[model samples]
Target: MGEIIYLRDQHFAEFHDKCFLLLSASNHIELSRQLTKTLHHMLVTKNTPVALYHYLPTGQLRLIYYFSFGSNIEYEDEISSIRSFEALSHSQLTYYALNGEHETWGYVAHPPSSYIGSTHWISSLVDIAMHQLGLLSAKCIDRQQAKLKTSRRLLSKDIHLFTNIEEILDRHRQRWRDIFHACGICLASQGALHRFGHCPSDHQLLQQLSWLSNDAEQTDVIEFEGSHQGSLAVKLSLAGTHHGWLLLFRDQPFTNKHVDSAIHRALSCWLTYEARMARVLADDLALTIAALEISHTNRQFITTAQQLASLKPAIHSAPRAVTSAEQNNK
Candidate 1:
């Protein structure tokens, strides 16, 4: 702490601000190696391992940079789940929020245990300075992406993705299955689980358990937070004559509105299938009743024909026609 403390530090601030302003105010979305390495060295003096983890609102971690050639992908993976949900490291090696209020961008880079409470203020100061500037960079990137997506959509000839209703439903069903390991959709009407898709080899066990896990009593959406806020689940009904829950599970909370919109759309798709099935079944039942009625009428006609034939035989035995020629002969 005492080393960096000085009356005038024009040299350090000038060097640090050069990289900071370049990264935060640049038109390019991609981070160059040179700028990042310079910036890392400026603030992160840790000869110890450090990694910059960019967290998505979906609760996924993307590695931005790793320093000191100490930690590799394995180390990053080990702590990814913890970073996704936990606000603090296990060691409590101070992490800067970098605008935790908006969840715009926050990273964790724990130094050596020696720096736990010592001289870490400089690192925290760097993060605080990066906050306002990072927001600007994030907004610019978002706008650029929005325009690209809009352009792609406009250039496409068709908006509808699938040719048939079943295709669309199947796509959604597959998405449901991917929400978690061996994820699936189950029917509430069936006492036994009726899994729709994403069946792993061991999914049979999951199928048996899905029926029991449905505690969704209300029609509105319900959120369940998992241990240490590391996992999140949102439950809503795919309701109709036979209602079932549409659920999503993620490593982090489902705070993204876009994700919520997609979930609701899936629920709507399921509801549409339910309504269509009801209509189809009613149509089939009507056709079945008509067929049975026709068969019954045909049976009655055959019985009447047989009765008429029997009467013809009785007439032949009981009566004879008188002729005028026979009367003249008498």
Candidate 2:
């Protein structure tokens, strides 16, 4: 019987003119009805396409909820033609997991353009919004889990840890190689670093990331050409103050379609899990220190714990509306 919580007033402002609401409630038909009822007023006022993303509780979090409204010309034409499909015009509701089990509820819609050459900006905005909401929901769950000692789970299951920094870098390198192979893309060459200092290859591209500033948590996609033409460089800043970058290269460029969205979604999920894992690791370290009768005031132990604490995942304090200016730039 967990309580349902809605996003704050600031988040509502971020929704802009479009109707958007994010809430956390238990997974049940009754709760879904409650959500539908809540959005009823919006639906009547503007029959824009509605999307709901339901996130179930994991070992890390408690409640999950997502709702959005926008107009998609392509989806309107497609769904409206379906006979007897009675929901608000071009509306859909989806239920999915933050970590596992991929499922979309209600009528699904695509980006409002052909998937081939178009930028699909409208759909991309919706997708990114949903992704951000999902991440935020997971952060909420992690916060709740932190309050219960018995609920803490192992972070190693989600994040791979090494004894040293070098090992971590090597592991990331190997992971990129694996991802390229699995995605049917060849990896020409790749490198990862903390601050994009100096790199032999892709120096200019890596340097571009510097402009994003240390506080930018969003993913940046860069297209490059060299031995492997049409390659894409996906770079993301890990959660927390442990300044590190994950750079991956693929032989093919990602479209603004399903493929690109899927990759980013997967990466986002991994980072969320990694953030939770960091918390678990920090807890374990503290417990170990105590078990060994080490003084809590020990500088080394305190420093290590503080470092881990700083690595906690970045959760969006408020929702962000994708503006037309930003879309044009992209």
Candidate 3:
């Protein structure tokens, strides 16, 4: 028997009080940490360990946060990587999948028989917490973006997050033009690449860009060299292929310590917007399918009309009975 935290029921005042802790979190990590603690406190049974995972585009879940009450599980030794869940489920754990339609993530657990809160209640609270985190993420990015914009020394942080792809790119091209006092910048993500300046986007972008697409749990902005000419790039990435890059040209040397930080903050908002657009594109694909169906039906009608027109010539060529008055006149 492992050491167990004190059990708490769903309907108690302490439950909501504890749940309110999730709302006060300032960032993703803090919010998730509170979540794990909340889960641990609710369950009465020892060895009823719970691990949180984020779903990736490659159909694997990456472990983000894990909570246990003195369980000796080997997998919990490290809190990283995209290990297969095949071996995990063999332990007879109950996986409560979250973000159902979006395929984001879920929690897997080995709850004992004497668990305090009902599984349904736990699941609902977990989902609500995740939803709260989403809202918190938006607010955090907004506040940070505003704060960082003022910190920029030279150029204006006038970029706007919009739904339309082209418009957003246009705004970025205009705003990020003077990232470092005439040092041009380029933004790329989601199958589209555009370079705003003459900086060498080929070799540097091709080599280091792959690192951001990995399954590692992203928590910080990845910054690295663009080229040997003192150029640099700031990367903002989330789960799976949801990532973007901001490359600055070597036009002007930047000495500001927080230049990358501002870009990082803005890029977070950009990635969030792009991810939302990816979901919107699904709806767009359905509309396209509907349009294609209509086009196919129209083509069929046109083909039938063409066939009727061709047959009309054959009918006209064939001898037809003339009117009696016409025959008499002939």
Candidate 4:
């Protein structure tokens, strides 16, 4: 027998298809299930426990399927007097049945025997398995890319309606509230940047023509300390920095695919909205400064023109008085 390793249910889902493929080929479902249960039992072992997994062609750990007998168990409280295959580490094993290694049928637990040989069977199994998994992974990645593309387009359209940051925040407040209700946590988050000339995050930014800081983003988190609660934290990045983040948690976290997708889409929309708002605000500020400069220039022109008008009369009177003095002397 071999050792089974402990892993969470979500972790199991990650490699579920691959493991099932191996088991179905060998008709080893019953054996695999028993092995998983046994692994759960050995999670709290005080002594060294065997780690069982198949080495993939990609040089990555795969099917790290199970662990061994232990003094206690956390997964199952009431242990039945069930005897499954015992797990043993390589050092403890007397022999390894290399013939047991195959694509459909993984290497099974065997009494230790000493033999060092690399056969075509092990190599072929790894190659075929790697190809199949690689294709599956590629397909998944493509689907995700499509979803993100669609999400970005929709969000960009929605953001155009918001004129300013205050409007964006107000409109999204309800959605944020709903997110909190669903996720079981609340995060009061904001983004801040000083005006171009006033920005002081870095000395270099001050010298630059654009007043934007090289890097100045803040992210804060406060976890929920409630019973049976779980939280999901996701940060949305734009232009190489975190522009926004979403905080969600719940007493009983909903694991539905639809809910997760909706949350993700909404967060993306919020980030796009924020970015657009910032641009609009910057444009408005520029307009305001130009207006102020024009007003100041007009005031100075009015004062200078009035002074010139007053000096004209004084010059005209001085010429007449000089003429009258010369006539009296003659």
lDDT scores of the candidates, listed in order: 0.38, 0.34, 0.49, 0.33
How are the candidates ranked when ordered by TM-score, highest leading?
A: 3, 1, 4, 2
Query: For model 2, what is the alpha-carbon lDDT of residue 36?
Result: 34
| Candidate no. 4 TM-score | 0.29
TM-score of each: 0.35, 0.24, 0.40, 0.29
Model 1, 163-261: lDDT tens digits are 322333343444333322323443222233334653322353354235336655532233222221221122222222233333323233123232222
lDDT of 3 by residue, 186-254 (tens): 555545566665655566666655655562864333323223333444553333323455554443222
Best by lDDT: 3
Candidate 4 lDDT, tens digit per residue, 1-330?
122333454423324444445434431223333343432322223322222233333222222223334422322111111112232232333212222233322232322223232223223333444343344435544554454454434334545554443444444434433422332222212343222111123332222212122324422321212221233334334335434333443333222232222222211111111223223322333333333345557778999999999999888878544687788999
Pairs with steric clashes in candidate 3? none
Superposed Cα deviation of residue 26, candidate 2 (Å): 30
Residue 93 Cα positional deviation in candidate 2, in Å, after optimal superposition: 16
Worst 10 residues of 1 by lDDT: 264-273
Which candidate gets the maximum TM-score versus the true structure? 3
Q: After superposition, how far is residue 200 of candidate 1 from its true place, in Å?
A: 18
Per candidate, the number of residue pairs that clash is 0, 3, 0, 15
Per-residue lDDT value at 288 in model 4: 30
For model 4, the stretches where C-alpha displacement exceeds 4 angstroms are 1-20, 23-128, 162-188, 191-242, 247-330
lDDT of 3 at 104: 53
